[model samples]
Target: MSAITVIINPYANRGDSQHQIDAGLQALATSGLAFDIQLTEYRGHGAELAEAAARNGAEIIVAAGGDGTVHEVANGILRAAEGSEGVASATLGILPVGSGNDFAWGLGLDKGVDLAIDRLRRGQTRIIDVGYVEAEGFPAHYVVNILGGGFDSQVNIEAHKIMRLRGFAIYIVAVLKTLVIYYRNPHATIRFNDETHEFDMLMTFVANGPRLGGGFIAAPHARHDDGLFDICLVHKTTRRDMLLMIPKFMRGAHLNHPKVTMARAARVEIESPEGFPSQADGEIVGNDVRRMVVSLVPQRLRVIV
Candidate 1:
């Protein structure tokens, strides 16, 4: 029952997170800080533990795994603050022991356990924006890094099936697998910043940070505290065209591609005639959602840098 709670996802990074737990906790102990640990036993367990901790008035709740872990912890903290007045949101800290620590990478927590612990001990925090998605049949989800629909969501699905590869390579292989297995794009109407656009799109991602899947620079100009989401639209294109664009995304040069559209907005509405797959922070949120609204909550989450 310490003030700082650390939620660890045992299966994250293919179980490497569990293996690294000792060293991570040892570092925290060496920092002379009192804390408590909670191990997630199943999907979404992190959020459950985090929510309980935040409600109990934990000052700092740390996600001791990867991006998915961070997403859950953030959501739990956000949910606890809902309808509660004059309560400061729990601060989030990352230990970054997962495979694709893209969100942690953006927060400068990818350096390893010791550095992340040092960051926590220093107590310097940044207030950052987080995105929320509301759709029928699904509870609201918080997107701390990126929320991707269509092609990228399909890629995430494929990536989950891959067992041997780790880190960025898994996403790279999944992208190739997606091209061969799921190539059809969906027609979507997107409204944001007082403008409307309708077209067949391969993918649309609303980003709070610059990277996804460990290395892909999906939104190169994104920032977490900007109070807006960086939205990228990938227009439908031939397989050959998609293959060519992959490299550009790696370096974040795809922003200028003729088929790609980049814009910043505080909120966005997406609707598709054909249902499309969607994911938030690398976790599949829905497989056949026809509509959803993504809006930025400005300076909502506090994170230890």
Candidate 2:
């Protein structure tokens, strides 16, 4: 068997990921890497392929798509590890061939197939923290980058509806659309680090990395190896206030805003009487999420840098 397994999501980048995949495959071939390629046929197929590859003793499972693909592949690897030693036997790699390559960007990876393949050839790896989140009516899953609930998740949903744009522009348009169409913030109770905060929340973002939505610096100080999550809570505010905060987030300068609360924690619990939407690594986890428990797992996954 090949030492590397590449899971490609053909539907990434709004269904235009084929060119990137082809380029990545060519680079891998030229790099003298012994690898097997698998294309995802449906939504969660990447995870299934990754799990099977790990179970079969693949040394590396490369996610050759976007952040959603990375999310699935990581979940699969962790799941496979749970059956054996509770430690991932397969390392993870990323080819940022998607709209929002937030996780890859946070890892300091350049935005080219050749560059990604070069990193894979170098074979440098690091152990990074992973987040495990469980919510009502949703399967417990792993988050390798960030999870956003409430208004942030609604923006993600709107972003997916857009077809003409790519990258950060899509998220910008989505944010505008969400404000007009979905503005009701949920009443949330958040518990973390022996403190409970109750408020009408606009959103709650937990970050294992410093960025999301392509370029939004959600947690500029976050580090994947830190064994803790940087949490951002935005209190319910007017649409005008949200609009004013957008530029601040773009600059990673919103932490000091009066409506924003930023802290670091290893575990967090959130509940709401009004069910909310949530997305992890750009994949929508659930729409009617009433409760969520998130905890960090230190040094859980090995990743190629």
Candidate 3:
């Protein structure tokens, strides 16, 4: 037994969250990890719990939910660790008990909850890279996986509404729904890698982890430890072309596509006259963000995967 705190979002999986939390505790008990679980009482509660735990010198904080839960907990831990000694030393652990679990998928932790617990018990740690988004009107924030905009964010917006379904099915339906409703590409200028390029794009992703939307390999070449980010820019395409390329994106074979631009950068700035949808780790950022700069925070997080 070590000093660990489990932050569980009761709303995760869109089902019986209490049952899920209980099951997780049961699993943890068998693993012999002395842990206490805190059920999130409301929105943004995960962050508060995480910050409190980290400030109290907890060694490990487990996000026992989905990507959104992980997002909030990471934000809390990073914020608490800011400008403090030994506070940021808390390593993160994940149990993929949420819809999609995209962050876990990218880290090769999508295997099973038992396996992740086993890894955690072993205390094996990997220090991975992180990202931060700086926008004009929004507070600066850290991102562990992907920070994306344009059509993909729209997909996230639609995907969150399908309460009847969970996981990849919901995303598939959302993708179809967005294709019909959100066909217009936002006009923008992306400045990065010492070059400024302007285009009307369906989406642009500043990727730290490779996969998103459960299985979409948006950045096939991305590595968590790599200081560089794999930036994927999809230029505007016709509706028919978009449909035709869906499978290619699923297989991560779209990198070589003509309309797709694959590049690596440590810093990127984007400006748009009319804002596009923005999302980080499957959560919507701002409704109308005109400008944003995404920069890499190298090896900022220690995780057990």
Candidate 4:
């Protein structure tokens, strides 16, 4: 094992993550571990730094922000591993500094700089499954948490415009705001396991881990090491029904509703008549995507739990 590379988004948590970044860096500096830190300045910088560091012999790549930062770092590591042999053996560490540390919560990692460091120092790591997406833009993206299209994507897009709130609160607001104006049930065909299903799909969630948008359990039983995605498909429902189901999502009980169905698959193929927005791990990744392939990458990355 070599030193670590910490990729941080200082503007995470609504630009309130600087304190956590400073504390994490200071702790790493004095921890007697050979390590270097990189602060991301732009949107894709975390991915770039992560890939470079992994290829250059970083043993562990730490993403010290929210799910977006982790998403970029994971994508970077996966890209590098595809070209480099030993790079795939590198582990991933997460310090939950972002507003929605959805992936971190799914991994059972507590939020806060000191707690994250303690878990990292404990040296317990596990090989977990990651989700892979194929679409028009960004040929491939590795998702450590969840990915979604349609209504869920719209909520994330709206959530980004909110600058004052953090965590579950902002997401709650986004959902309400989105329901007021956005309503789209794209004609969708989903195929998995030799079966084809059609729906007027309002939203679809493919989860590697459990949480999406902080605590909304899109797939309540999703597990990262399982090598299969727990899928949540939302069929067309009335505006009143959608509004009433917000609390159900918070409790992860939406699957019991008539409009939602849960399934599992190693590979998922989706085609929709209307191109719509798509997001994964809390970051809006693509727009107007009419076709996509989601597959499970088993034992893709080692993560400290």
Candidate 5:
């Protein structure tokens, strides 16, 4: 059988991820599998480690951190595949030790560390789709879950500013702050799957998998292997409407609101009259740009459970 290499992010989950790693390793060892573990030292190190493991013939490369670590590792594996010859793709696995673990939640892998590790040891792999964002100023990259523009990106920016908070609190505080300080309706023209529409949108999210920022089910019906994306556009609304929608979002019922528009497409392009801020997988991208393209890569990854 092929060996597994786990790339760990020690700083995940407010620096409590090491304990999870210890538990995960114990479970893997109990499963009688030969595996190796590598800890990332800084930003982008996990991606580099994942690339090295893939090139070294690892059959499985597990991301042992949060969403950022997962994103970096996926990028590394894809980069390695693009640069290599005659190498089969390495399967990707996640042990959710991050604050949000939103991608894990989408996979129904939010049970706990032991369960996630057990699934990994069982070696069940499923091919899932990934999303990519390309724009004028930013580098093209992949997003395994949701990508956001406008108000949502501002939340991500604010959340990072107060990283000391954990999970939903970070997002909740950021949302309140954004609502009070930075809420703006940006005029945008969106084209998806050949249909074009214009609106003054509060935010636009292209979702491959549901949920972001811990528990907000931005796209409740998203399926990662469906070969399509759920595009949600929130029209300009009153602050009272935004406040009322928060509870609905917590219950994954925000789509019922009249101001929220949801559609499924294989590709989407957003053009803003004065540009907008955007974020993918909790990473900020772009400032003021004319256009942004979002697309999906179906069954592009084999993930553990």
Candidate 6:
């Protein structure tokens, strides 16, 4: 293995992540590993840096930011290896410095930067699945954790409108506001494998990992290497019913609710009549999506857990 390249997104966590870079460097130094660090100057810079590092013979490319940073880096590495020989694979590592480290939580990489760095230093790797979202008139993209459409996507957009809060608090406020103003269900026609169904759905979550929006375990049975995605559809419900189900999401027992339906599929397509918004890994991608096709990429990346 060659040297590790750590790509830090300085803008993550609303500028609270600068200290994590320092902590990561100190931990790497203590581990006596040969590595180089690069700070991303702008959006999508981490992906470029990771690609360059991999092409230059870097053994590992570490994303030292939040889920967005990790997603970009992973996409870069995968793109770089598209036609390359099998021997030239670059593994991915993560240092969770974002507000909602959803991917990190799935890998059991908690908030401790030093511990995460230590795990990277030890060089343990696991093969994990990745998800790709193909929408009409848009480029295909990857998400490490969860993706959603309809009400959840609206909530993601509204949450970012507030600049002062982070993580669960932002999501909570956004959900409350959206619930009051955006309660109409969108007509969604979904096709999964050999089955087809249509519903008036409040939201649809296609999950590769179990958690999203900080701590909401939206898909309790999702696993990255399962070669399938757990799709959760929340059908239109009364305001009182939705309010009652919100707490069950925290306990990860909402799947048992009658209004919620869960299914596992290798491929799923969703068509909505009202052109709803969509979100992947906490990033909102705009509104009125006519169609979305989600597929799984099995054992796509080597991740340190």
Strongest candidate by lDDT:
2
Tens digits of lDDT, candidate 5, 113-162: 99998898788888888876788777888888999899888888888788
Model 6: lDDT of residue 133 = 85
Query: Which model is ahead, 4 or 6, in terms of TM-score?
Result: 4
Per-residue alpha-carbon lDDT of candidate 4 for residues 1-305, written as tens digits (9 for 90 to 100): 35788888888888888888888778877777777778999998999999898888888999998989999998888888885443276789998899888888888885588888887777799888888789765567888889898898999999999988877788889998999878678899998889888999999988898888876888889998987999888999999999888888888988889998889999998888687789988878776888899988788788887
* Global Cα RMSD, each model: 1.2, 1.1, 1.8, 1.7, 2.2, 1.9
Writing each residue's lDDT as its tens digit, candidate 6 over 167-194 gives 5798889888888988658888999979
- Compute each candidate's TM-score over C-alphas: 0.97, 0.98, 0.95, 0.96, 0.94, 0.94
Q: Name the weakest run of 10 consecutive residues (lDDT summed) in model 4.
A: 82-91
Which lDDT tens digits does candidate 2 get at residues 1-305? 69999998888888887888898899899889999989999888999999999999999999988899999999999989885544588999999899889999989874688889999999999889999999988999999999999998999999989999877899999999998998668899999999999999899999999989887898999999998999999999888989999998988999999999999999999999898999999999988799999999888899999
TM-score of 1: 0.97
What total of clashing residue pairs does each candidate reach?
0, 0, 0, 0, 0, 1
Model 5, residue 87: what's the lDDT?
A: 29
User: Which window of ten consecutive residues has the lowest lDDT sum in model 2?
Assistant: 80-89
Q: CA lDDT, every prediction?
A: 0.89, 0.91, 0.86, 0.86, 0.85, 0.84
Please write out the lDDT profile of model 3 over residues 59-133, one tens digit for every residue: 899998889889888888888878854325888889777887888888878776777777778988888888888
Candidate 5 residue runs with Cα over 4 Å from true position = 83-88
